[model samples]
Target: MYIGRAVIAGYTNEKKVFLGYILASMSFPKRRARIDEESIKIEPLKTADYNNPYITYNCMKKVEKDKAVVSNGIHTDVIANKLDSGYSGRDAIAISLFAMDYEKDEYNTPRIAACFDNRSLYIGIIEKEKIIIDKVRNDRCMLISTYNKTVPEEISIKRSTAKDIAKELCMLDYEHIICSAVVCRREENDFEFATEEKNRL
Candidate 1:
């Protein structure tokens, strides 16, 4: 299935918090994930495509030690800013998704996001026809995507390390895998991060 872009938030069997983002694009597959000390950005390999709004974005942001935000668009930074400004994970995700609505692109692509802290996890989607925000169970992995898998669904993630988790997400049966980024809690306010690109597989 081509689930476009996806976000996963949950806890590993060891009870470590983890968040991940996957870009599965058929239209813009020439993209790669760039991870820094603070965030994960998806960018086009070709400089000429840098200005294309839909293809370049900060897909995940670390707001604080224990708080992080993940999304398919600019809303990732928006939600992270909201958290930095004192909103809870659920509220930040809900407000940002509501304000951004869906991407105003040719497909009217829905904006999907996830925000999680040490205590809670929230996933949201804003589509042209409706908006849904869900508080997910932290004991298990939950996934939300911009295309067909817009609703949050539980998925098993047995991998406990950030690098393995990223590869696991990229290796999912989803078609046209572009790239993936993942973060796993390491200590109070610290996380281990990794990224995987399908072209290297």
Candidate 2:
């Protein structure tokens, strides 16, 4: 799976606030053998590193810094702790990206699950004791690292919402995969399980 970070608008006590989230993509494993669609299964990801301060605070600030936004009023350490415990161990995060073919409430409150067209990013967290980014290609995704501030900027982020970022990144990744396909292989199998893993260098 590809590992990265992002900011998502979260609600607390009905108050809207921008919260930082560490995002990852979870897909089918490459090393596994495939059977009939119905019989195929994969292991559910387990995580114990939810309280990772480095990911919670640093990931959020990295995205904000890309937009030239100051990381004020953000408790890099405290919020990190919250994310650790708040994690439901859920894989797919259903985020609203586009408008759906549905109506809004009378008060114009948008329904999260129904009224909005959404895209989901699947992910999992590795051991919190150590975060290692490897450069390798697997059936799941390729891990990519962001440029270090102590060094130079390798990847740049444009100002956009999490939904926008997800959609565009998905598209960017799709395009690259399509362009790199071999014609002979294309005819042999349907291209369905494909993804990119972004990581920190």
Candidate 3:
């Protein structure tokens, strides 16, 4: 039951599509950052930080102005590149996850991600089987993570600033929480995405 990474999306009263994530890792270190103008990267820090494992390595890449690929491992780059090459969020997520299959790590961790923008939200998971929630409507967010639970795993966050939600996730008892990123489409007409990130440190 290792659901160390997750994505959330839904609409607020302002009519904005919001996407958020919590990267949890009890085994490896994590860092949250915006590496460049478009890409916001979050991953396990290297020996550069401390001894770590490739099994837990991960990253986030911006697929477009509004869309981003947040994943449990290098698969983030794989999916993000496809998006940069002009694939729609759906096709890019499918093609990338289909090719990579699941992580071959000893844990056999599933590969999971989200393709999120102002107008749409998609969640993709790859394990023994694959499931893609192509579009999560405003009524509620469709959330799936690395491990499947017998009970429903989805939870709702009260509409608030990005930092508020991230902090709320940190308050959870789950010992694996590494960091969180919250992206909201505040601009109604076009893509004007604003994000806030906080590392477990």
Candidate 4:
């Protein structure tokens, strides 16, 4: 199914915290995930239309030693800042999604996000009709998407490494897979990240 941009968070069998972000877009297939030392950003390969504010933004960010935030738009930074400022994962996600509301595009696309630390997991979505922030179990992988799969649901995660987890998420039965990224906590303030783009397959 096509769930648009999505964020997944949970713990691997080894008990390490992991977060994955997938950019599944039919409209912006030319986009790719750019990974750096600090964050992962989704950017268009070429300058097409910058007016669509939702198309380019940081998709994942580590705000603190134990906290990270992932989202489909600019709220990624907003949520991360809130976490950096000492808010709990639940409060940061809820307040950011509530203030940002949904994207103002033609589709009124919902804003989906996940904030996670070593001990807690929170996923949220802000749609035109409603807003949801759910604190989910850290023992199981939970997914939230901008489209059809707007709610958080548990999913199986067989892979443990960052690269394998990212590729596995991109290979899911979802449609229009553009790129995927995974962030895994190795230790306090240490993280391993990897990304997979469809064109590189």
Please list the C-alpha lDDT of all candidates, in the order they appear. 0.87, 0.20, 0.60, 0.87
Ranking by lDDT: 4, 1, 3, 2
lDDT of 3 by residue, 104-126 (tens): 76767777777764346666777
* Minimal lDDT window, size 10, model 4: 45-54
Return the clash pairs for model 2, or none: 2-197, 26-122, 50-84, 144-199, 145-199, 145-200, 145-201
List, in order, the clash count of every candidate structure. 1, 7, 2, 0
Output the TM-score of candidate 4: 0.95
Writing each residue's lDDT as its tens digit, candidate 1 over 1-201 gives 889999998889988888899999877777899997789998888744544687888988888778888899998999999998989888898889888889898999999988875578888889999888888775888998888888889999999999999989888999999889997887778887899987777
Which regions of candidate 3 are displaced past 4 Å? Answer: 30-36, 44-58, 148-153, 188-201
RMSD of 3: 3.7
TM-score of each: 0.95, 0.20, 0.76, 0.95
TM-score of 3: 0.76
lDDT of 2: 0.20
lDDT of 4 by residue, 1-201 (tens): 898999998889888888899999888778889897779999988755545667889999987677888899999999999998888889998889898889998999999988885468888899999888888775788998988888889999999888989989988998999999988888777888889987677
C-alpha RMSD between model 1 and the true structure: 1.3
Candidate 1 colliding pairs: 65-189
* Model 3 lowest lDDT segment of ten: 189-198
Clashes of 3: 2
Candidate 2 residue-wise lDDT, 74-152, digit = tens: 2322222323333221211111112121123232211111000011112211221222212111112211221111111
Ranking by TM-score: 1, 4, 3, 2
